[model samples]
Target: MTDYETIVYVERESVARLMVTALRAHGFSPREILDGGLPGIGTGLTGKGLAIAVPASEARDAQPLAEALLKDMVGK
Candidate 1:
């Protein structure tokens, strides 16, 4: 669990927060990677997008749940 593996990317911070809650409920320590898109300013400065990631050791187990949740939220 030394490294983190990104599981899904979402455009909205609200969505990322939802994913964080879902992952926490599943007993996973999820981390948020915020790439631009500040509160009022869409896409922020970086414009790289937002991401939800889990520790490398838990990635395999967390990926499916993360993807399912993201798909449900964004339809992608």
Candidate 2:
């Protein structure tokens, strides 16, 4: 595992939710997703829109799967 984390940004909350689900299916904890928008804006919090946080330990495994899921399903 590395010493750093990475973030993935998606345009829509539905896509973010889908990514969270896909990551979970691929063995990620639900907590890994940052849920970075929509709710944030609603609550008057600054956000980066839809985002997921890949913890350092999970990043190596999660990256490819996330990219695939986003590309294949979300058309990212």
- Winner by TM-score: 1
lDDT of each: 0.78, 0.65
Cα lDDT tens digits, model 2, 1-76, are 4354554667666677788888888887544444344453522243545556666788878878877887987666
Number of clashes found in candidate 1: 1
> Cα RMSD (Å) between model 1 and the true structure?
2.9
Structural similarity to truth (TM-score) of each candidate: 0.76, 0.65
Instruction: Estimate, for each residue in 42-74, the C-alpha lDDT of model 1 and write its tens digit.
Output: 433556556678889889999999889889888
Clashing pairs in 2: none
